[model samples]
Target: MTETSTGGKGAPATRRLSAFLYRHDRLRLAGLLTPPILWLVVLYIGSLGVMLVSSLWGVDSFTGSLVKKVSWSNYHTLFTEPVYRTVALRTLGIAISVTLIDLVLALPLAFFISKVVQGRRWRYALLIMVTMPLWASYLVKGYAWRIMFDKGGVIDWMFAPLGLHGPGLGLTATVVALAYLWLPYMVLPIYAGLERLPESLLEASADLGASPLRTLRSVVFPLLVPSVVAGSIFTFSLTLGDYIMVKIVGGTTQMFANIVYDNVGVAGNLPFAAAAAVFPIVVILGYLLAVRRSGALENL
Candidate 1:
């Protein structure tokens, strides 16, 4: 009799709480969003804040100990040093090259998948194949590229008939590897954009006496800019911070990320590494702001 009485009282209390929550829509929304908001603020933004603060601290040159005092010596070195400038420029060039290569390759392929492919099964299978490379480990893909770029490897074997040879391990190989790694990031966005595009627009262009090439240039290209910008954000930012792919295939080519890795791991200078890390963050922020100003981010 006592257990039955307690259980009967608990049921009414649970009903009251659920009824209260259902009555207050704003409160319910806040309850749903609070966990993820807290997670983002504490983990992502908090780590970035810590890194920015650490970048201001100084390092002792002689003893290799942290100086604890704040200073701008690290940023000053990055600006004044010619080698740092060279590495920064090289990193930017590689990133831009990779973005352009992926853009060219993805445009035709994404169009085919979105517009020209006849059946649903064929389209899905091709999309899966485009993304299949991502299922493998990152290092595995890097080393695989290294092997193919090696002397007498698959690349050389393929080119032997044409009396040419592989570019071997260097900037050429690094760019090619980075391009292959990030191609899917570029493809999916463009494919989705193309899928959302109205076929009637293309029909109108054709009925108006526009050729397919002209229709693509005038009608399709303008509508796809936002997706292209979205895709470039992934490709460009990823290539900027990548160190491992360059390490495996870059040979003596030192990128901006390599400088940061060396400072922290090899030189034992955490302050300098944090400062070096700020460059890409700033660059990406600028790119995002520019995209926003152009109204492309709204569509995305």
Candidate 2:
């Protein structure tokens, strides 16, 4: 061994730092994770608990503060008021529709990217193309759709050559915008699942007498269930809470979250806003539970 190889003490600095970290500063390592943990407990969970408790609290006329009060009236109002039920259902329905449409599209796209595209660079390029839209702002995407859908805008002008002037844009355009915005969230997860699939299974299926369609159904689809579930959750949860898209495109048709946001910002009703805020989580959890109860949960 060469004594000069140590280079006059670069090694000792690293060793000393490592020894110091090991000897007396577990607290530093612990402190690194504490902020996110604290944020999860204090902000995420604490807010949910506050919302649940506040939803139970009745609105006081004089005090203008919701203090300790508990009753089922708010939830009852949610059910009895046809408008509330309709808005809530519309949000749920949109989420479900978007999720279904996303899966239908994403499955083929993901599978094609994973299996058909031969070159590594091209595969990555295609994936990045699909994913690049995700980096764009949600508000920007909504507004982009709005720009396209407006009369004399790109879509109307392009279709005018065929003498096809579409319905003047609003709710339908919003759904298209929202769907485009959330599609990548579904695609990425499913692509990850498909990309991780073992090539040997496909070989074995081919060795046996299964066609490509049968192999996918019998082998690939079952293995991809976790990704499917995860993608659905992403699309459903994101669509359920969308405000900018609904406000920009639908204009008058109120989504459940948009309604709550408007009540908080515009109408100045904190208690009712809290009640409405509770609605989306309940819908998300209900779907999650139902999906879990189904055989799809085996993926998890």
List per-prediction Cα lDDT, in the order shown.
0.94, 0.83
TM-score of each: 0.92, 0.86
Residue 154 error, candidate 1, Å: 1.7
For candidate 1, the lDDT comes to 0.94
Report lDDT (Cα) of residue 201, candidate 2.
Answer: 93
Candidate 2: residue 8 Cα off by (Å):
8.7
Q: Measured by TM-score, how close is model 1 to the native structure? A: 0.92
Candidate number achieving the greatest lDDT relative to the actual structure: 1
RMSD of 1: 3.0
Ten residues in sequence with the least summed lDDT for candidate 2: 166-175
lDDT of 2 by residue, 175-215 (tens): 77778988899999999998889889998998999999999
Q: What lDDT score is found at residue 106 in candidate 2?
A: 97
